[model samples]
Target: MAGLYVYSVLVVLLLTCGAVMATKENDQIIKENNCETKMGLPCFLEAFTSIFETGSISNKCYVELVVLGKVCRSALVKRTLENPLFKDLRPATIIAKSIQTWNNCLALIDSPSPSA
Candidate 1:
């Protein structure tokens, strides 16, 4: 009966571990999907770490904006707005632009716009 008891414990532990892993995966998927839906881009830091880390298109664009002192957050917001895929994003274009201006101003106190 000792063998049976050990086997039962092993089975229970395995099942518990499996359940935990499944839950973690589900949570990650939900987070990634939420980020994608809101941003109109893949979940770079979450679902597509390799792409982001390796400087894929979106990642490269983000880095460029940051380096240019262009307010990365506004650039991301503009990207989401300009893309037809994220048409359902909230606050309207006017509000989005206002927010972008605020973000840019908050970050870029020196020159505002180099190209302007």
Candidate 2:
């Protein structure tokens, strides 16, 4: 019984440590890359919704997201998935959505605009 209890405690501690390290890494990436300033709060929320839920992002917001870059976008999504509020969400599905959204925005930005 004591061994089982110790084992459970160790598991919890390892999980907690892993979460903290992931959070710290995400924060470091956000700070070092000036991710927050890259996109407005409204656009950030739009992008989040677009990736995590069945919401659409505006063209303006798409531009903002594209400018935010893959590293910042990926880290933000990973960090959000770590939140307790998002505990029920599947990380793999959400991550795939994030990548799709980023790719779409990148394509939109990279392609030449149609002539007037």
Candidate 3:
């Protein structure tokens, strides 16, 4: 019974150590990703407000917003996937679609206007 208790305690200690190491690695990744620099909340809010005020923004404006939104979303999705906190969440497909949509919007934005 003493031997079994020792084994169990050792197992628990190992698991705790592993968890701590994983958390440290995740923190390093988060720091490297520079979440704040990549997605400034104030900038996003300002852009959103501008879009809302426009009532009916042009395609170019919409495309620009979409590009920024997609970049931000993709970064967050990637960070979440990397972080242990959200490790249980399945791999994301939405980020890929967001990138595709942003690309398509950019193409449209680049194309000449019918009158031009």
The lDDT of each candidate is 0.45, 0.93, 0.55
8-58, model 3: which lDDT tens digit per residue? 999999999986776566556556655445434654454333322223334
Candidate 3 weakest lDDT stretch, 10 residues = 48-57
Index of the highest-lDDT prediction: 2
> How do the predictions measure up, each by TM-score?
0.30, 0.88, 0.39
Indicate the residue-level lDDT of 83 in model 2.
91
RMSD in Å for all candidates? 14.8, 1.5, 7.9
Give the alpha carbon lDDT tens digit for every residue of 10-100 in model 2: 9999999999999999989999999889999999999988999989889899999988989999889988998999999999999999999
Scored against the true structure, residue 47 in model 3 reaches a CA lDDT of 39
Error of 2 at 74 (Å): 1.1
Question: Model 1 residue 22 lDDT?
Answer: 56
* Residues 1-116 of candidate 1: C-alpha lDDT, one tens digit per residue: 99999999999999989766755554565454443334334433421222212322343434433343333333344443444564665536535454544454345544555685
Off by over 4 Å in 3: 42-116
Candidate 3: pairs in clash: none
Superior by lDDT: candidate 2 or candidate 3: 2
Please list the residue runs of candidate 2 whose C-alpha ends up more than 4 Å from where it truly belongs after superposition: none
Q: Which parts of model 1 are misplaced by more than 4 Å?
A: 35-116
2 against 3, candidate with superior TM-score: 2
